[model samples]
Target: PEKRKIISRFGAFHGSTIMGAALSGLPHMHKSFNLPPLPVIFAARPFHYLDGLPGEAEHDYATRLAQELEALILAEGPETIAAMIAEPVMGAGGVLVPPEGYFPKVQAVLRKYDILMLSDEVVCGFGRTGNWFGSQTFGMEPDMLSVAKGLSSGHLPIGGVIISDKVYQCVADEAHKVGVFGHGFTYSGHPVTAAVAAEAIRIYREIDLVSQARRLGDYLHAALADALNDHTLVGEVRGRGFIAGIQIVEDRATRRAFAPELRIGTDVERRCREHGVMIRNMGDVLAICPPYVIAPKEIDYMVDGIRAALDETAAEHLRTGQLA
Candidate 1:
């Protein structure tokens, strides 16, 4: 088998185990263990809210990114490139959503080069993105789909890859040649976890959870937009379905981020926790990914909590000379 390159986006959080951490693009994970041993290539993440240039339309941004990908593959030699992995919504990477036409264009580039496309749906699968899978939401048809997180609704630890027929057949033939398949975790197919996942799938289908997530996601987005859009420190509000992010900045007009020493996101997160709400903060962005079972009232509460936290943090900043 020829060596293959695995291309990943910056700030992505695939996992924390050795190989998983290496695959992750966030520097925090690498601080403890220098990683990405040899095969991984880092690429720019398509976060429209933060990285899209001024006056650039979403479609153009996507096109430019796709072209950049093609250039990278050519430079690295496509034959050596094994796969390009991505999250349809870029979850732990601050809920970074791709610009319009981004996934489709990237998929086209991958196909042109015959490189495998791996959709890492760990955080965007199973109704989190208003669809059964983020690939459906983003129009990506991948060779392999890695799913986790909502697979069991956080009820159990389980993850697996859905390999396409072509890849499956190749692996099968290769295994026969080698007399062993040779790749599996100790708990790769644990029955208990599978049973929990089975039940979770049943509930999602029985209740039409995908549609519900879509509906509630709309409510969540509107509520957050209404509450935080005008805040002085909010740079942008972006996300899909139940997963969303409010990017905090020192200058909202210029989208200038606050100093790292300020730790504004941390303060906001602490305040949200004080208000009985949990939110994940990445740099200056505050992310909210509530459970699918939450009701409209709970949605209101979540928004209110975020609002209160932001307001309080802003007030504190003003008092301390951190904000003008």
Candidate 2:
């Protein structure tokens, strides 16, 4: 049977295409684009910070998420589901880093239902996630992994899919029977892009940037925790490696996000830029994804800038009587 339904999680940002938008669970993208309706199922995101229940341990949270996934797959009829696509670290969806055992348990459920696990490594690939791929960082054994963005280190736009031997064999046999495999884009194999990507891969190995990201990530996370964990507006500080998010909240004790109209995230982002650092905000969560080559002093500078920006933004709000 041709399994056409692919499962995604809430808050995921795959891309901006008809098919990609359909696979993504963000409502703004879907409504704005008038995305073509496609067969896509949504499962709960394993965001421990926001999604985990009170008194729930990390492993327990993982177990609960896995159970929810199993339930979703069963309800949808596992056979009809072709694949479950995920990012090792949820980037645009608020830098959601899954619990320690989350991926392994989720993969076990997918295996029982004969569903393929697809890893979208566009953001977490090429040393951004402290590993060659986020799959390695998170213990995900994906049947196929899609990577881009970091392939040419954002120097060239080239994306590709890596498939396991079993899947490749099936595809090869099908193409053989059909006499021609009709697929892919005109820029798929452009020599310039290929050359640039190849050189980038070589540089990654030569400098061992993955290890550097891992080491620097520890510094970044720790610095962020020390500086902002006790702040009134900070609800959570979470992430791994170079990809991270700082959740801004109206009520820190309750972890209630600031309303979109307040534009807290955008305001903080502007403040960071004014302080000589640039970051993006998804609603009230500020995302930080720095270069793999960033030095310790640079990390300090960026984190410091963010701290100052937060303070400035808070002061401005207080002065204007906008903060409650």
Candidate 3:
């Protein structure tokens, strides 16, 4: 009998555990680590900003990705594949938002192959993606889900997996035969953490944070576009809701990245800090993930700092004769 394997994508981050690390596709997470325990396969990242082909429409790009997934499944023999996991909006991997119709098409392919779809909602969950969950925002119905980060609003460490009835039934049936579940966390049901998480959920519903995130997301997008869309060094500004990424490039027309040696992202982030704001960068992509309670003025302040930093960085590059 052949064992099944899990499929993930490049630039994707799952977690820091043994198996989760194996499932992650980011090299920094895997460098010198002996992992994957031999059953994880990586697929192409669904990042349109960097991966989309010139002259290709979003739908077309999504179709190509679906076809590639199907091809991979067949090559590996569908029976030998178990499930595919993905971040509805990839975080830690450049905040890549998938092209329209991407998840739905990928779901169809998985269904045809009898493969489960696992949604990694660690970053995109709890109002970050303008919804309670990214699955709903992007039109996907996952077989299983892993959620964290905002569950307890970071007051305490907690995460959980939600399984569909089918998966639950399988595990239950097997456990009945074995007379033991065979797995659990030491802090599985710590009362204090559970109580805090419960209150967090209650607050989320009471305050309607999801709706606020949606409204603010629209404002943030518009502000970012208005401020940076025409910037010569900004190749792309893309994201959803509270999560966003700004791609800095040497040449916007060609999307040519500044040489890694320049450390443009680090400098830009440092400059933003000097202006009283802080942003994280992965290579040349600057990330903006503000608190949910942030006000409109704060959003403007954040963007203003970023704009000033970009100008400063550009000036430095010119001074160093790295630009014309």
Index of the highest-TM-score prediction: 3
Which scores greater on TM-score, model 1 or model 3? 3
Query: CA shift at 122, candidate 2, in angstroms?
Result: 0.4
Q: Tens-digit lDDT track for model 3 on 44-114?
A: 99877778899888899999999999999999999999999999998888889999999999999999988
Question: What is the RMSD of candidate 1?
Answer: 1.2
Native-to-model Cα distance after best TM-score fit, residue 195 in candidate 3, in Å: 0.7
List the candidates' TM-scores in order.
0.97, 0.97, 0.98
User: Model 1 clash pairs?
Assistant: 5-82
User: How much does candidate 3 score in TM-score?
Assistant: 0.98
Tens-place lDDT digits, model 2, residues 1-324: 768899999989899888888878788888777666799989988888878899899999999999999999889888799999999998888899999799999999999999999999999998887888999999999999999999999898999999999889989999999998878897879999999999999998898888888899999999999999988789889988888899998888788877788899899999999989989878878999988778989889999999998998888888888777
Model 3 C-alpha lDDT versus the unseen true structure: 0.90
What lDDT does candidate 1 reach at residue 9? 88
**What lDDT does each candidate get?**
0.89, 0.90, 0.90
> What shift in Å separates residue 132 of candidate 2 from its native position after superposition?
0.9
Clashes of 3: 0
